[model samples]
Target: MSIVAVLNTKGGVGKTTTALNLAVGRALQGRNVLAVDADRQGSLLAALSNRGEREPCIAVAQYVEGQALRQQVLRAAALYDDIVIDAGGRDNTALRAALLLADKVIIPFLPRSFDIWSLDDMSALLVEARAIKHVDAYALLTMSDARGTDNEAAGQAVPDDMQLLPTTVGRRKAFADAGGAGLSVLELPAHRDSKAMAETQALLAAIFN
Candidate 1:
């Protein structure tokens, strides 16, 4: 079993969107998936509410406070091959614990100055996180538009010192619309934006494979 944690220090970076779509994509690939909402706001839980499975997905709030995390993982692992943990953006002990529990870590950043600044903290956390986990950690820039900004090229460009994923989820109305209805963009496509979908899919594929 693998524990994939979606995290970032800054809010509104599409961390939840990436988490939801990636887990759904993993499930679509024939891997049973358990998704956890570690954020206090329950964004992941809200998204999965309509999932309507006989058994509910495990939200991380219950286990994030203590060593109960091991038990939580054990219970969920019995039912799913993949476990996706949606961690909080703020710096806290709970978030640190989630990172320690993750097999692989994903930091989703937006293409803005403050969003870029958030990666500094993300990098430090993962550095310590890697000492505990055996897998590679990745960073992905979300809501990016290459043709729009002067920083576009550099925005999507992976930091030389940081490990990053190859795909960047572009700014799109579809993503925002899907989140409002508690659905992943993959589940709700208004128009054909193959680029965004492909980028998202590649990120999901890379995390699982």
Candidate 2:
């Protein structure tokens, strides 16, 4: 079993969205996935509650911090094939605790100046996390422009300690719409944007394969 934590020290970096989609996408792939919301905002829970009834089922849990969070994740490790933790937007006890157990950590950032700058903070946090335990980390560019040098520039800015995923998700309306409805691009109806689905699928493949 693999424990994956979707984390970024900065807010609005698509941490929750990535976590939600990752959990649902894995479930759709027939994996026994459990999504753990370690964020106090509860965005993951809110999204899952609105998920379509026909979509693949994904078990979920919430734990903010302290011993309980660590204990529960350990207990869940025996039951789920994969555990996806949605950590808060900042460095805290929860995030630190998650790092201790996560086998992999996905850090999503936009192709922007602020988001690029946040990578340093994340790198440092990961350094601290690694001091305690070994955890593989990756940087994923999100909300990238369809055609621009921004994506390339941002990809190059990723910290050396973190591997950058080749698949980049564009700034597509389909993501926002699907997120609002608590659904993934893969679960969108017949008119779903092909690019969105393709990007999401590519992301899952890059991470899970």
Candidate 3:
């Protein structure tokens, strides 16, 4: 089994959205997925509840304490093919705990200056964590603007310790539309933007490959 933790010390970077979509995507592909909500706000669980019966069911567990979180993940590993953890957007106990158990770590960030600057701190944390664990960590660019900013140049600035994914999720109405109703962007109807769906699928492919 593989455990993936979606985390970023800075909030509003679409970390929960990414984690939710990843869990649902894997479930759609017939993998037994378990989503762990480590954030104090419980946004992940709330999103799953809002999902209703529209999307594939994903098992969920909540663990906030660092040691407890690690123990829960270790125990759940035998029951699911994949575990996706939604951790708080800070260098908190929950995030550190998830990092300890995660087979892979995903750090989603916006391409803006402030968000870009935050990666330095995250990179340092990841570097230290990796030294004590065997985990593949990546930096994913999300909420990318198609206008004004140079996405490519921005991606190049990712720290060498973390690999930057090739596909980026652009800021689009489909994301908001789907999230509002607790649905994965992939589950959006035919009228939805194909680019949004395509970007999500590309990320999933990269994640699982």
Clash number for every model? 0, 0, 0
Candidate closest to the true structure, highest lDDT: 2
- Of the two candidates 1 and 2, the one with more favorable lDDT, higher being better, is 2
Give lDDT tens digits, candidate 2, residues 49-107: 78757558778889998467899999989999999999958888898888788998899
* Residues 9-82 of candidate 3: C-alpha lDDT, one tens digit per residue: 89999998899889988898899999999998888888788877664787877888888898889988999999
Model 2: weakest 10-residue lDDT segment is 49-58
Misplaced by over 4 Å in model 3 are none
Q: Residue 77 of model 2: what lDDT?
A: 95
Query: Model 2, residue 117: what's the lDDT?
Result: 97
For each candidate in the order shown, give its overall lDDT on alpha carbons: 0.71, 0.88, 0.87
Q: What does each candidate score in C-alpha RMSD?
A: 3.1, 1.3, 1.3
For model 1, residues 81-113, the per-residue Cα lDDT tens digits are: 888878767976657766787778888887777
RMSD of 3: 1.3
TM-scores of the candidates are: 0.83, 0.95, 0.95
lDDT ranking, best first: 2, 3, 1
lDDT against true structure, model 3: 0.87
Screening candidate 3 with a backbone cut-off below 3 angstroms (N, C-alpha, C), the clashing residue pairs are none
